[model samples]
Target: MEGVLELPPNVVLRAEDLSVVYKMPRGIARVVDRVTIDFRVGRVTAIVGESGSGKTMMASALMKLVPYPGKIEGRILFRSDLLGGVVDILKLSPKELRIIRWREIAMVFQGAQNSFNPTIKIKDHFLDTARAHGLDEKIALEKACKLLELVKLDPERVLESYPHQLSGGMKQRTLIALSLLLDPKVLILDEPTSALDLISQKVLIDLLKDIHERYHMTMIFITHDLPLIAGLAHYVAVMYAFKVVEFGPIDKIIRNPRHPYTVGLLKAIPPLRGELRFVKPIPGSHPDPVNPPPGCRFWPRCPLATDVCRKVEPKMVEVEKDHFVACHRWEEVEVSKLWT
Candidate 1:
């Protein structure tokens, strides 16, 4: 606990070329491949793509939370080499991982509805978490009260109530509070608002933004909703198959997408009043990651794919300063004229 006070606000997480692979019933499946990214000192980075894009898989690799039957590869550097040493998540012992789980890095899951304990009182869960980490019952209760208050929940009622007693929104609020139990430096949220109503979703988004400002913690948001991510993230990384197809500042990636898969994604999202009408949802489904396409995963559905696109894997190429895209014909392919 004494060491917690000295941790500063900076680049708190570095996931270098991480990968998560599962050898399933059929064959080898690469859920996440070569995912190299970071969360900054006090900003939000959103990983946006359609379902099965492997955004969630990449998030799991960072936390070393990928379950059994799956293997994680690559380095997870906590801080820069000078201040904090690099720790390979795959190599860490459970005891060593306990220190990182919630105290240093926390997670807000997409399906909070399924995460709560039915038999345990909600307050007991938070208190128990604190207790497990060496805090006494009384002190844990007090801290739990503070944590719930931050999320705008009634501490007393929630402490005594069971998971079923609370509404869906309330449960998620509780989960958010729990993820911040030890004032974590990094928070990974996977579609935190997917299960809530519109009003509740807005409330949670506002609460998260407020909390992000207050804690100045690095956050990585994973969601399929493009508009939602656009409003929240400073930078966005777009995924197709198990790899990142595009990664750059939000404006650049959103306004002028280079990857064909990314362009197809933008096409799927509806536009507002007078907005350009270029985007048309790319038809057909994503290629199965278990046995992914040899060349481009999106090639089967990509209308612009040429013969070469079907033959060679496209590496992420620098299209602009700070803008990386993985597409073979991005330079010559001009689809900008389609939207008008």
Candidate 2:
């Protein structure tokens, strides 16, 4: 008789062919296409793109935080109790999902200012999460205090402070501390540094990296900053309007990118001081997700796009070792000349 298979503890989170769509007043708008991604224990997977790239939407779907009227599909695999324990997240009821949030999976929100309550103190919120989850309140408060210190905040003062009383970076770190109270297996951070200044952003990024190492927590870092990902991420997923055009190791995708969109994105960044300065922008704005183009979503703006690119959706191809790209004519494109 076939029995249940058991998976090792290291493989924490997995998503296979996940998709999200918003059914608006008129019709359905695709926010995420068939996408497969994984977060191994103790590593950072960075999802990066421009605004409207659907990175945020995809992360939101992973946590089952999307509001009603939004349709999310595909398998989100978490280590389950039976058989290697892989189950479909979409099938779980609200009550079943409660276990996953804050315990198995947690999120560090993008909007630091809006994620908290102005009326409540930080300690009270910590108490709420701890008590609600059946964690001992006194122990939870101590743990929260330790987490605050881990993020380099004043554990004593920050706990007593209100959300409005903290700076942007401070609030961000406090949110991170809250996300870790349960020692979640996976932490999804949506633009964690988008609200801070350059100095504060660097400090917060380092703290996050340190926390990931200390806790062995798998992180899904959602951001629009490629340079930052190049420095921190182990794996990179490049997103366009609701689709991933390329996905690979951070170095491979940055150094010898294949997709036209990916290539353009790399070139668009301003070089560091003392390095050769260059600037270029992706030729076109992202198309509307509600009414996307028939062929490749990036074809309209792709400088190297051809008839096939314009008329047919490009399938993700492994042109090199462990590197995946979705472009009709990767061989014909000249990124060096076009982008230069």
Candidate 3:
């Protein structure tokens, strides 16, 4: 399995055979399947998939924050500077995990409104987070102010105002600032541009790009938007039905996607500047989580699926240097004109 192989030195975090299962009244729903992927240091990796493809669940699993009733199984090895070595997040105690949450890895959740306390002022949020992490109040305040400014918000005004007083864009930017307060090495953002206007989305995207260039932090951006990652991500991991189907450098994935699902995603995106072409949505709905189809979960929707694909699960295999595809007919997919 890819999880057992020796990882490159640059890998800051790795998830090996990671799976998330929820024992609901209906049945066992595996939101995240046995997946293994490496996150390189100082690179922006985008986890792209449709809604309910387990993007958010996998991100939560990385931070050991899967809510009750959802059990995570597998190794989430993080190269921790605090521990002076690699540590499996799932193995860490609650206290140890708390120490690492913001100081080592922070998450900017999807909804900015829900992330903040309505009654408290913005500065209090910063101070509260710092206090929880045992950071000095004075130093934390200074850093918070600087981060607010970095995100193009006025510290004086933002710090005094409540969450309701800020615009959606302001709140989103503030959330980003708050996530950076502890200077975490890895930042996970779930649907960062959700519920934002076009202008706000563009601004947030630019801010994220600037933040990455300035800090060079390892970032995991979870979004279904394919075009959005084109301008932001260094690497792309395409997930389908709770499993990563294709992963490679952004350029390679964009120019030559080798997975049928990935090609479907690209074709679904409407082009703004190019020859006119019909936009075709990927044909089937997402698989039922509790009882997905047998063998290759995507075979039902995959145009090139053969008898083998319906009988045996395809393992992720290297199609090119640093590029992988988990498709039984990847060679046929590579030469197909679907995406081109």
Candidate 4:
């Protein structure tokens, strides 16, 4: 709580110094290190990092949904109109958390498309979700039909079909519709387009853009795809070794990345309209979660690392308006020189 600050008026949700640790037999794995980030109202904030950089864990921590043996430490404040003010989500009881889950903040989890019950029809999934939240079944079905249409799915057909009867793309779209059944103020999606084809991915992205514009809901997208963020996210938080190395407006972060990791990621993205060039993958593998390097977690892999980077961890500092980077020599990071 030392570094926790008051939430800004525009911020719908904020995580301050959040850490998630799993107690394993050999050693404790600190999957999500002290991460602090804000999700602004009516904007999509993408959390981008390598596969095991704890992107999903951090998102799960926001809803207090970390599985057993995994302990969460820190403050997650949700600006709730229903609760009448900002409430620390970590302090809520199980019952209170359940009430807040779908009605206030819903999450379309990673691989949620395959999580449906095989025996039940799609309409029953909606009814069950509504019943759990104490909503009227008849009204919920009516709303579900409307939401299905909004996602460009045929309501009557999808509602009657079972989970296996739909294609992967259709199931994914249905999951999105289900998340919106309660009209949550905030929506968290973890790798929404992970297993979809390129065409399905495009359709989903366009649908998400339309949903954001129409409902004005705060959305948090968790993925490693920089290309997808370019067209969808308004802001981005670049994570490395479970820490946010850079955060700012999507355009600023893409056009002028300050963190060495961020620059490396941007350089790896192939340009759409240009002479084909070699895509240089970032050097070195991700650090071990249980015992990451001292000082800076990224020091072992950072091209711009110095003696200080290996001995003293850098704090997050504002390089420009609303743009923050955590690097000892952020000012000296030359995009072209690091990879060469």
Candidate 5:
């Protein structure tokens, strides 16, 4: 179990029993299991998981942008000072969702730079996105300049450059600028620093911290990089096999994670200032989403799993004050050695 960081009453977004199912010729595959989470205003919550763990799908479901042939279910509630009331995103019509997309909520997608058209200049991309939301070219240009500066980019040079002319870092910064063009309250960043160099990744991390503090925006950072989130995020959600196995404050999770899956993940991180030691990766692969095993999703790879783990589904339990773990043998598992 980990410790919980209680947020203020001003919650910007919440997902209740959120699930995404894909329709296949054989049968439906549930990619994102029933995940419920509250993203507070002005707080950074990082959702960390390996590939195929449904982290990106969770972000996609938040924006109602899940790929076609995939159907989303459950309540995605969004409350903002701009909206003046709590709105259920799943219930919103396509037109209404569009209204909220950039102005009220924005997403910086994974490989977002690749989404840019090679033929178009970066300035046109920003102008076009802004114009779609009804802003004049003049206003769009001014906002673009300001956002580029906020992201530590030279507005003049970046705006004039094409997607291919800029470096990877510059392209990423441009995407960030575009996402903030409407000053949305909630920004969902899906692997914002994925393919960049280490230096560029650090720069992006610093820029994100600045943006969160400056705009007081609720940022949901989706990535598989657990180490990167340690200092940057206030809260963390550990997902496996499409479900959240453990979640709480960053410090609590780092110091006292109760879930075996979470413990395995922490063990895999190489310590920066420690005696050189071998890092053990989590054993076994994540279950197939379409034909996942019964009972606890992590049971197959969990070392402490028992007979009960193979039969009854383990409900999420509060093992420590505000710390939740969804494993029957959480108390018996000893993972404290990883941190020490």
Candidate 6:
């Protein structure tokens, strides 16, 4: 857990006390519960969690993309623009949001291949984005071709092919290229490698690293894959039951996790080549978000839970220098002799 990457105080985007509540027929479901995290400029912060843990909802909520019937309440602050000054995205109107989205803050949505138009060619998709953003046609085409090559694709062949013709990896690369068309300051990628094979995933990881270095834009990676995060992300936030259970520099979380939920997640990953030969899955299923348990959400599944863990909710406590955990038994988790 040594040599953790320390980011400067240059924050590009921040979500403070972000919450999302859905109005369902049965009852209201708190999908995202008071989540707060800062996206450091020119760095990759991966929000890791299991399905239904509200990782995707948190990502979309940052961009004001929460679906209808769901009410989002929070302050999304953007500080990258010096001329325009600090702006709260939550307060922006539709017209104002459109001006910043894609142009200033682009997103490569989850399963981004479905985002393409079936009837149109790849080039036309780029053209559509360019037109909507009010880019010059001739200049846009030139830049689009360059971006396609940057993603390690044959621009000549891909530009003519439809969405269905290209492979999943190809489509994903195209989406990345499209996101870069506007040269946004912050890029949000949701599950960038969910549907890819091992080889494709590796390729995408390398491509993303190259892109990050080339552009120096703030990147937020949202996924459940620990291995992928280990390879690409600089910081990580571990979430469970719509709340962040642990957060810190990636190396510290992976090497010496203090939260029981984070320990379970790390134990679940099978080592490709190491002294550790097996994996241990977490004990129980995630709690229902609509009516979560009163105390710590992980207490129902945690083997180390005590009486207080089941009675009072644990607040985020800084156990290490920069590492934080929201657990009553974090001390026991840290001193456990069995796992070591």
The candidate scoring highest on lDDT is: 3
Better of 4 and 6 by TM-score: 4
lDDT of 3 by residue, 45-84 (tens): 9999999999999999999999998999999999887866
How many residue pairs in model 1 have overlapping backbones? 2
**Cα lDDT of model 1 by residue, 73-148, tens digit:** 8777675232255455556678877877777778887788888889999977887788777657787777789889
Q: What is the lDDT of residue 214 in candidate 6?
A: 90
Query: Which candidate, 3 or 5, would have the higher lDDT against the true structure?
Result: 3
lDDT of 5 by residue, 1-340 (tens): 1243233476778888999999787777999989988887788999999999999999999999999989999988887455456778888778888889989899998995687999989999998897899988998899899999998999999899889998899899889989999989889999998999999999999999888878888899998998987778998999999999998889888888889889999888888896877888887898878988899887788778889999898888888776788989888767765333
As for candidate 5, its clashing pairs are 1-258
lDDT by residue for model 4 (157-200), tens: 99999999998888989999999999998999999999989988
Give the range where candidate 3 is weakest over 10 consecutive residues by summed lDDT: 1-10
Q: What TM-score does each of the candidates earn?
A: 0.90, 0.93, 0.97, 0.97, 0.94, 0.94
Which 10-residue window in model 5 sums to the lowest lDDT?
1-10
All candidates' lDDT scores?
0.79, 0.83, 0.92, 0.91, 0.87, 0.87
- Candidate 6: tens digits of C-alpha lDDT, residues 170-241: 999999999999899889999999999999999999999999889888899999998886887888999999
lDDT score, residue 117, model 1? 80
Q: What is the lDDT of residue 308 in candidate 4?
A: 99
